[model samples]
Target: MTKKDDHKDPALVSIGSMFETGKIRKMYTLAELYPTRIAKSLGINYGRYMVKLNHPDKFTMGEIVRLADLLDIEPDMITKVIYAELN
Candidate 1:
């Protein structure tokens, strides 16, 4: 499937919901999950910047993709909420 198709898949949609709902604890418990690197690369600290950005409120698809990339997740994993707005 194309990348855009993956973004519209139900599974990835659910994953993005986890992010939107602040269920990060569960998601981050996975050993492979790591968003800190992306945050650092972007010169941000997830905790501080999230608070600064008022996360769960101001998140954009582009921002989500950047975070997902840092966490080694596919952009689709974090785009469910912003996809409509993005398109």
Candidate 2:
């Protein structure tokens, strides 16, 4: 049987690798998981959601918690990424 990845387009895999550095970016996570749906769940428009993602420090405590729940990740994971990016 062919490996699942064997069917993947080489060009697409190469481009995907370019974005898969060890560090995970918040925008990438949100974008990959459907930003529009997330924005609606957060009661905000896509533009505002994008702005908040671009400026991590602008996120409120409730938003942080809600995002963690939505993303199925620990709250600290999100905070750490934001802190690391800022520092």
Candidate 3:
């Protein structure tokens, strides 16, 4: 099976497809428009934060909200990406 078929998570596949299609590029750009400078202001470690939220680390909704705020994007966008990957 191809990698897409191997992926059990449709949301993740969807997000991946979105990226492959360049749909997420703007969002990614927007998210990173501000560097770690903002994260530092919030006492957040950018890489560690992503690892915590995206992988082994569990992130609270509040933390997600804080991240969204720091990234200057709606929390829903992040949630949508996650939910898309999960469901």
Every candidate's CA RMSD: 8.6, 8.4, 13.2
Off by over 4 Å in 2: 1-23, 26-29
Give the better candidate number (1 or 3) by TM-score: 3
Which ranges of candidate 3 are over 4 A from the true structure? 1-22, 25-35
The digit string of per-residue lDDT tens for model 3 on 1-87 reads 123234234433444344444465233332443435544544767775545544412556876665555444455665665555555
Q: Indicate the residue-level lDDT of 10 in model 1.
A: 53
Q: In terms of TM-score, which candidate is strongest?
A: 2
- TM, every model: 0.37, 0.65, 0.44
Which pairs clash inside model 3?
11-84, 11-85, 12-85
- After TM-score superposition, the amount by which residue 27's alpha carbon in candidate 1 deviates from its true location, in angstroms, is 8.8
Q: Number of clashing pairs, model 2?
A: 0
Q: Which candidate is the best by lDDT?
A: 2
- CA lDDT, candidate 3, residue 25: 29
Candidate 1 lDDT, 1-87, residue by residue in tens: 123443353544444456655564332232233445445654667675445233433555566666564444566644543344334
lDDT-sorted candidate list, best first? 2, 3, 1
Can you write out model 2's per-residue Cα lDDT over 1-87, one digit (the tens) per residue?
A: 123334544433332333344246554455554678777767888889888888889888788766655544456766777787788
